[model samples]
Target: MRDWFVASRVSAGFIVVLVGYTSSAVIVFQAAAAAGASEQQISSWLWALGVGMGLSSIGLSWYSKKPILTAWSTPGAALLVTSLQGLSINEAIGAFLFSSLLITLSGLSGFIDKLIRWIPQSLASAMLAGVLLQFSLQLFSALESQLILVVAMIACYLIGRHIAPRYVMLLTLLVGCGVAYQLGLLDLSSVSFQLAKPEWVSPDFSWQALIGVGLPLFVVTMASQNMPGIAALHGNGYRPAISPIIAWTGVTGLVLAPFGGFAFNLSAITASICMGKEADSDPSKRYLASIWAGIFYIAIGLLGATVVSLFAAFPQELVTAVAGLALLSTIANSLAGALADAEGREAAICTFLLTASSVSFFGIGSAFWGLSLGMLVHYFTQAVSKKKQLMKT
Candidate 1:
């Protein structure tokens, strides 16, 4: 209804889409390029990913009345950049199918929820804070390169935070664009308006792809993407059924694999924009922002080629500053939640340090390791406490 179409919700949705594309769309393009996709095939990949995220976002938000945002697995895309080498496009599709099947089976088995429940809230929040600390830190590191641009954006953000809090990111983004244009940082000469068409590739299964690409994609998507996503939701005091959402992402990814939707899952960093107070003060109404995100995603799918040029026009510094500014509040909240519990303070700090380090073991990412390590420390501390109590008694 028109009543739900507030300016803040609309702005939040726009910010979510902006962060999604700016953060990792380039990496996704590289993955497709690595898989030997032609221009048309690459366009179809964007089309499939866009459409898959769009429809699933809309449907899930409607069904749950929560701001359930979906995204292409950025970590999975990065994995493909390395693991997908020497694999044919058809074989890559087979790997995608295998990953989706595993995601679906994990959801159906209800094991994911149980595993998530075992993770302490402090540890989860710590991992999210650690994951996001990089972006917030980027704000200052960027000043070294583009002083005026970063300073102006930060000033605008501080001013907007005090005056009109709901539109802080929107205002900051506008200021960044204007400043970038004045500095001659934007390059729009290559920009074009073109609609993308989908091109499907029939899958050819191979055990090599299943082992190399599929397993890695499934693990990273679950560990890196969905884990923080669920943590973000819990940190914000929203608890929806996790299994069904994961299953929907699986089904959606499976449906769009041939068209180049490598993987789809709950978003971590970007979803926080929609889940936070920036989206809407009333949690019940925040779903509207996600609906708007879905609408923008469908438009992005339709205007696939144009998106490439559109995003390219802005300087890299501008994009990084804007995303960092947009997430400042969320990062603050995540860190606060992470350190709130005294019992798990040490464990949480360990998680934060490990995750922020960005170290990886085997094919898995730092988020998983951070959580695993923190949980181990927490259990060890609890056992010690129990033994001490018995000795005292």
Candidate 2:
């Protein structure tokens, strides 16, 4: 293990993973707060999520001997932010438990896995492209807000990629920090060190919350988040066992639900960070990177408040630019895969555009709608092609 860590460049990989994961921490907190959670509840949420992600990443990656990472559901977090208005905290906890239970059942029954199997590779790729397009565009779009920071990061990324592709993410992050500090954008005064303590809450079941919030959250997290996450892993040339990962996430979520782990599942964006070449040259050794990530996650869970404060010290724009740049490769790969098949080109285009638009309908986010419409179009096109082939025959 020590040799694996040394060969995989564990320190560099850890820093890269840290920057990639911590960049989104603030937004996660904001989303949790917007979900009607109290400050303590939000703190608990972080604790649960951090611990769940940490343990799952450690156990699964160790067991599978691959870089399998787990993360809180970003879409599910956003869903809670908008949908939990006027909802009780107990009810939200209930919804979380219910969702976790449902996910657990899905993993056990193999229904979800079977459903994913039926989805054409083209459509899955398209859905992934749809999900990630906005994030990719943010690389350039963020320049409008913080030109110097974004430009510096982008330039550093390009230069680093040319010189040392493995350390591009690390170098870009350093550049972002330097640029942000030079511009007086970072506020280090707020930084402090402390340990995070988990606060437990009792779960209360509510039918209203279950139907309105839990079911939708579960569906979106599993479909929009986990589905794309698994696709990303497979797309990236690593095929970790899916059932055990999902089941483990469910188990973690169940254990931490009362403590405020809203939703735990496979990660897409941050996982990509750890699974990429930056983590290791030999793919087999990449599990060490995940093990390192798990350690950081546990540290964050133990020092949740301090971790949040430290991350908050950095300028928002700097983090945004770094995140946007770090994800460029994954986004490009997803786009290429999505449009690879001529038969699904139009449908894929539709999916990409709709998701990038960030439109919302009936309180559900655009990712779901984009996938739905793209699938509809893909099926229709496939039917038409079948008919034409029959005629020719």
The TM-score measured for candidate 2 stands at 0.89
Highest TM-score model number: 1
Q: Candidate 2, residues 254-273: lDDT per residue as tens digits?
A: 88998888888887767776
Backbone steric clashes in candidate 2, count: 2
Error of 2 at 234 (Å): 2.5
Best by lDDT: 1
TM per candidate = 0.97, 0.89
Tens-place lDDT per residue, model 1, 157-233, is 89988898777777888899999999999999999988889998999999999999999899999998899888877
In Å, residue 301's CA in model 2 sits off its true spot by 0.9
- Candidate 2 residue 158 Cα shift, in angstroms, is 1.4
